[model samples]
Target: MKVRIGVGHVPVGAHDPAAGLAELADELEAHRVDSVWLSDLASAPHTVDPLIGLAYIAGRTRRLKLGTGVLILPGRDPAVVAMQLAGLAALAPGRVLPTFGIRPAQPADRPAYAVPPGRHAEVFEEALTVVRALLSRPNVTHHGEFFHLDEVSIAPLPAKPLDLWLSGRLPAALDRVGRLADGWLGSNITSGEAEACRVRIERAAADAGREIEPDHYGTYLTVVLDDADERAVGALLDGIRRRRPDGADPRTLVCRGWAAAREEMRRFVDAGLTKFVVRPAAPVTSRRDFLDQFVAELGPMET
Candidate 1:
């Protein structure tokens, strides 16, 4: 398997992350890493807006693929997000990859501007169609259950069609990805489970008469340097446990050290999922320090 590795994170400390993202992008590019991804969490004051943050990094680097591990699609206007992505596509050319996901249901994590509780799926499905039409057509008119558009269109289309990837592991969500998405970007699932999901997605793709690249299947794996601060591990798990409640051993979910992380990567590759984005599983005093060491350690392992 030809594995590709990338790194992403929720910016925890940097007050202004534009310079920081740019610097990190530069480092990733220097190490010949496949991409640099950003996690989108608009409500988190500590996190930067993924789209805006990526634009800054795009301007600074020429090679690293700037991606959203998963951009929330339920809360915002699809036309607006499509326009922003379309503009970035022009500026950055063929190096943009977007992965779509739903917003958090928890009250505190929900964006100040977001779809109502329990109605996100409805809005997201409609808006995703709107985005697809707008990105592919010079004139798009959509009148769906949750959105309305009349002969509207976005300018400066991407040099190539934008392939929207989806992130999820539930049966319904996996089927949706196979039917509507170009690829998958799952997380927190075991290799055996990932293989099962891949089978389901393949069946869905075949039924839909669409074929995706073998390499587009990917996942986000939480990783922390073995020697990272103990207090940091506790803080990180607190945040992660809130999102992952399946009772899988946290150690199984996280790569505790460089050797362990690489071994886990190989297993995922054997499972037919090679594209990966590793995010720190613990808090750290220096984002740069963590990334600097990570990229260097991971460089020798990439195929």
Candidate 2:
């Protein structure tokens, strides 16, 4: 299987988002990196609107694929997102990969969507259907519990298909991915866990008379390169708290250093996962320095 790596766009502090992304898009291509990704966080200060940032990156560079770790797909108009993605696809056809996620029942974030927390599942499914339909054709007429459209359409169909991927480790989410999404983009789970879940997904796909591409399984790994694991863990705890399953600490999920991170990728490769999006937890103090370290150390390792 072929291996591909994508760098995640995560700002640390006091940085120009555009400059940072432009530099990253260039460096990623220079390093032979396969793709670049952005994290969508409306509440977090370190994140940016991935749709906008990724589009900017797409315009700045050629041959570098763009992606999102997980774009929240709830509590918004599916038509707006459909139009935006269609526009982005027009700019960068096969190069764009947008993964959708139905966010959890967070009180602060839930209110903005207006849909009850309990109904997120149904709404997410319907919205995804609408977005898929809108992206594939010039016009779509859809009627669902969350969205209603009358022959609405977007211009400039993508040169190639914009395959939608789903990210989540929960059982219901896994089943949803198998039944609906074109691929699975997961996080917060180990390689062994991913392997076991792949079986479940395959069964669900069979039940649904659908199939997921063999090499589409991937995970979003947050890597912390620091002097000590404790320091790294402390810095990342607040951000990944929700992702830390059971009683697992931040250290259990995040890579401790360069060697550990490479080894983890090898483990994932052994588990039959070939795609990865590695996000750095530390600040991008120097783009050149960060790219040098990331490319030299964390670039795809031979298995």
Cα-lDDT of candidate 2: 0.78
Tell me the whole-model lDDT of each prediction, alpha carbons only: 0.79, 0.78
* Candidate 1 residue lDDT tens string, 153-206: 789877678999988888888888888888899887778888898989999999
lDDT of 1 at 86: 99
The C-alpha stretches of model 2 lying farther than 4 A from their native spots are 10-19, 104-108, 227-232, 300-303
Predicted candidate 2 versus true structure: per-residue lDDT over 1-303, tens digit per residue: 677777787453454455567777777777767788786667555446789888888887878898877888888788899889889988887788999989832445545566765888998999999988988888899877778899897877776668999888888998998899888887877888888778778888989999888888888777776633454457567556755647666567778778888998888888878888887766655656666787888774632
Model 2 residue 198 lDDT score: 81
Give the least accurate 10-residue stretch of model 1, judged by summed lDDT: 10-19
Candidate 2 clashing pairs, residues 3+ apart or interchain: none
Residue 181 of candidate 1: its Cα lDDT? Answer: 87
Q: Which candidate is the best by lDDT?
A: 1
- Go through the candidates in order and give the clash count of each: 0, 0
